[model samples]
Target chain A: MPWGKQETKPRLSPETIDYALAKAVADGDIVNLRQLFAPASPLRAWSPENIYSPKYAYLLPPSEQEGERLFQEALALVRDPDIAEHARAQLEKDGPPQLHAALVMTLADNAVRLGKFGAAAQAYEWLRVRPRMQEEFLRQGDTALDQNDIARAVAAYHAGTGLAYNYAAFPEPLPAVPDYQTRALILHADYPSTPENCVAMQDPAAFIRTALSYVFLDAETAARLDARPLEQRIAFTAAFVRRRDPDWDAFAERYRNTCTFVTAFGRRLAQDTPPAEAEDGGLAEEIEEQQATADPREIEARLLGRSIPEGEWWQYLKELAYEHPAAALFVARQSVGHGVEIVMPRLREDCPLVEPLGLDVTRTSRP
Target chain B: MNDAGYVDYFAALELTAEAKQGEVRKNYRKMMKDLLLSIGRERLTEEKRDRLLLDMARLNAAFYILRDNERRARYVEDRRRVIALEEEWRGLAETGGAGAEEARRQFDRAMRDFLTTYMEDLVLEAGRDRECVEASNWDRAHERHAGRVLRHDRHRHYQKILERLPFHEVTAPRVNWEERARVVDAILTEATR
Candidate 1:
């Protein structure tokens, strides 16, 4: 209907629609522009050829210049509220033949920008159902993709190209613990008092889930985690990440050196520096020179020697295993003492402690 | 009245969803008379007359679908999914916890599937009806599907979508959930309307 040959004279003179459009454009009259641009508008019957034909040449811009001016002016008034309201009214009217896919799409977008969500939805639903709009809708989607507009691309492709909703739509990682207090309430556990690791260190289940989502599981898999109890899932994740690293001792030695240096340096800096003048270079140089005299074993003991409850580190270690498996393996190697090569392999090969997690960890992992 | 893009053929003919074949025929005649009266009152050019015929063809298509009991039942079953998703979306919005993102994802998938399937049905039905095919200029055999046209149309829609979702990054597929949420919220408004 937007274009075709005119076999007979139009009911209204070409001047009627042209004059109306020119007036609307000149005055920035959004209401008239909305009606004039509508698919069902009598103006639609006047294709470029028809408007420029000898019969209507008097109404034409010398070479379509006048038409271009009107189009430019209409473009200038596109975001007007009256146009949006007219679009909304048409959508509410729910006439299938009157709706234009591109026009409605533009107005729907304006509604979204204006925070008129209800109006935008109306346009989306209109575009969604019309088979005639399929080609146009796909065009909208393709255009969005070409521009690298992922969210808009996803929206258009979902409605137009039938692109399925997937984890790819959610490219950003969700908060590690979206709402800490709500999760604690759900688990019926006490909230952690210390601030450092908070939920990640205190609750194994929470830590494992967040770590898996961040580093392993796709959004779909992470969202639909098994309904298993917390401890069981933690045990499962711990075993999953517990591969036998061939260079475990070497990695552990490096970690021990880093930890020792960090702990000793931290203590010296805390004692020697005033809170307000903490960045004083002279004090830092003197502490670094004095650091070699301090015993590494003694410093390690002083910092890590506090009696941790038996199960307090249990969850924290499992979480560590997910993020830094070597760290957890180092703790295990120290506890098992010296024969870890034999013990760890045997544990992996023979242990029936954890049930199969029954998940694909490689789904979103890079090839 | 148009729930989830389901064509209320019954409403098209001024009948209820439960209308039997006899009631459909009775109402179709009455509706046709009213349409003809309106068309007669207007002085139509050749193109305008053809355009108006599409309204008549749509009414005919509605009758075509509803006259058959099996098709009408299938229509109801299909529409039910859209309505169900609307309810599910509402519940997810209210709960607002871990399930929120996943639920919204599922709602989007269902809505897309329903709309695609419904559009396919409309296309297929129109293909079969001579009046609709003529009025709509729908060539079922030679029709360009989204898959075929996407290579050409992609650029245009991309610009449109970018304009709608402002400040969009053109390099990555990372979604701005807030902007996407507004559009989805608008879509839900229409679905529930």
Candidate 2:
């Protein structure tokens, strides 16, 4: 209906419908072709001389039936490698740009509908590279989701981004859908890990604070954990972190060194010295000297010794763990004395105690 | 207090008509307790006991009548009509028209009919109230429980009505018929808006 003028005399003629169907197939107007070839319509009898003309040569169904029926047949054919291969070859020898794009999109959509996700994903990849077909990619993505195909869905949604500016303007624009990026991150991977994918972890400090929430603790023991004495809490967290670490030996030292560097670097960065002046002055030299000479253990001790308010130290440690699991584990090991195992024995070893903190600890580790 | 035998139930409960439902129940409970305590401490001379019983019966009757929203609304409407009728009679008498006496007689007949109908309702209401009070007392004795009291819904209705009044007039003690009608009109206007 949005395509306009269903009753236009010239557009409604059988000849016009045939031309239009071909044009629609050529133009990637799958929606229009669907409407034109609806059941009980004369256009349903029209056949175009394209990749869809031959029975085995077709990528899509060539029968003079309704569009949906044609689509169903096409979806079935897409599952057959020989038929699919024939269709792709015909599409490559395209007479019209519209036909080529339309055939590609139809194949992708049919592939998605038929639960052929790999084929759908490949077709969608091809469609995305073509001109002005971002919305088609989005449609394919949504179709993929309807079939419960997550990989293609993530690919499609990710492709739709940065293409919003190409669409027509609205009078009263709505707020952009929230959690699109988050959804992509979730579907693309198990959780936010890399810096580019994990938008929430851009701020290492904030990410650390959120990681300290009761989400990480067992629901039944969360209240008791909160009530524990500070020393006990530290010891409990240390054991929790170590047990969770996949490679505690490699992580422990790296974490400690990174935290020390982050703290000292943050301190030096916060100083009022301007960049130009700092380059010429001893400030840069002093920071470099400290970075080289300061024992991470002493820095960790000094940080822990400071009168951090109750509950804040755990939060700081949790945040550190999220951004740098090793750092958090190292801090935990140092605080509670590594010998004590605080968590229950029955807890699943494979299950992560906390969500991936999605922070880039390596960036801060660099001098 | 008006000619319609419509006593201010709010006044009987020792409250302003604007009192909230919670306030009404709290004050009603306090009043009932105080009345019962006073009656209990007194020497049970037959005459004194009969008088205390009558007072307790009146308190119970007033509470029952006021607590029910539909009955209270009907009572308020009747009171307003009685005031209107009285004003009409006074105006007719001042003119001293030929049919003024006939009009006055018709008005008295109407009042009698209204009173008869209301009296029947009052008798039934009083009987229901006595049963309710007895049942409540029995329950309290057996369960050692203070039963939940029904709250007057009219307080919310009255508050909403008051909100329609002019800002300065909303808290005023007295509101005339014209001001009240205007407030109703304001409510209608706001609802349409």
Candidate 3:
């Protein structure tokens, strides 16, 4: 009989599992590392009393678990003043984990030199904590809520607010789509689309089903991610500036504008552009220039006009309507008379139908 | 070999329409053994022999149908839809064109695939080709069954004649015609029944 199933089994201490996992990782045993970090690991939920000791150098791998939870906590530990001294002392012998770690470590040092406290905090924290966080965070529930636990997204929407990271393991959605294709999915909530995040999108059904998964994420992100293919979402977001008010020459103003973030504390963060590098990129535009344009009706209607992701804009608009009914009517109207003028035709891969859409309208609307 | 004239040969032989060529040989061998055992070797009147012969012929027909995969496949498919069609025709004066067309198409497709797999043709010419050779094989089987029964009767008749001669009387041979009367009566009874 299985041990857990036994009625008279002894209660296992959560700390014992944590120590074993730490020791296993320290021993450079991948098999033991996997078992220690398995789905039902006893160590996962426990908060660490002393996490950033360099003795715990085994905790250095962040990109593995899709930047999910346990790893995020490991990120916070390196920033803890209590453990920083110990971690630095051990780094002398063990060295940092790898080159990426070295670069991030150097980057954090650069942040300290520049005296950008928030940036330096995140940079230093990522160097110390994120590696550990990545070491053991992939096996939360089969799926992560974009950010909100299912308990929240359920209150407002039934369809996509919560997505199953692996649908075969957890199946739910309207259009009954799986959550694999989704990313940074909820409002401030995020579902990273690392190759690991969407292990199931490997199936063809996920292409459309996951593309349809925005049934519950916020309108901007849903509008941002839905209707477009993955490669296209990247290109579209490449030009995306999350903020609007900052000037390139001014750091104080830019930092003030750029400072709004939702997920983690500075020390817990990693991967994004450092403050120094971002200074050259300029802060995201603050004022709504698109809203300020000479034509407001033209802009509103033209918004959903060019197709969101790929194939037909009408179809994507329909998915948008299905995903966010509260926003769909307004978005759907954009696909109406707003065809040629505001369409970002340059986004052809995502908006394959814009040219065909214009020609369709020209051919039909010529009465 | 129980071929009540009203019943079809395949049904009389207790065979499904889908029975394949090899299955026919398997089923027929067991069936022939049972029938001959039940009837027993006996001298029979001509009428009794004629009835048995007719029954044997029908059995032969059933074996032919089962021996060819193509015919059997079509027979199985047609038999399934035939009931649905007859019921529809009986229930309404007008057969809906679409429904009829669909059923017809399904039947046509199944038959074509079956024929292509087994006989390579649907027409009567298909029966004449390799399938005819198949039918003749079963016909030879029936003749063989009749021959065996005839030989058994002669053997029993001679044994009965020898037993009647007494050991003390040299060359004693009974002239009583009733000596084999029982074997003859048994055959006649089976014919009328």
Residues forming the 10-long window of minimal summed lDDT in candidate 3 chain A? A166-175
Name the TM-score of candidate 1: 0.25
Task: Residues B99-170, candidate 1: write the lDDT tens digits.
Answer: 544555576566555544443345346445664444334454324332222222222232232232212011
TM-score of decoy 2: 0.22
For candidate 3, lDDT tens digit of each residue in B52-168? 654444455455555667656655555444434434432332443435434544543543343222221222232233443353333455454544343333223323322322121
Q: Per-residue error at A307 for model 1, in Å?
A: 90
- Predicted structure with the largest TM-score when compared to the true one: 1
Candidate 1 accuracy as lDDT = 0.41
Model 3 misplacement above 4 A: A1-326, A333-367, B1-193
Instruction: List fnat per candidate, in order.
Output: 0.00, 0.00, 0.00
**Tens digit of per-residue lDDT, candidate 2, span A219-299:** 222333344344333333434344334355444334334454545555443233322333443443454566676432344
**DockQ of each candidate's interface versus the true one?**
0.01, 0.01, 0.01
What lDDT tens digits, residue by residue, belong to model 2 across residues B12-38?
678776666677667667777887788
Better of 1 and 3 by DockQ: 1
Off by over 4 Å in 2: A1-367, B1-5, B45-47, B113-120, B130-193
What tens-digit string does per-residue lDDT give for candidate 3 at A223-263? 42444455443322211111110121132221122222211
> Which pairs, if any, clash in model 2?
A26-A98, A26-A99, A27-A98, A208-A319, A255-A326, A255-A327
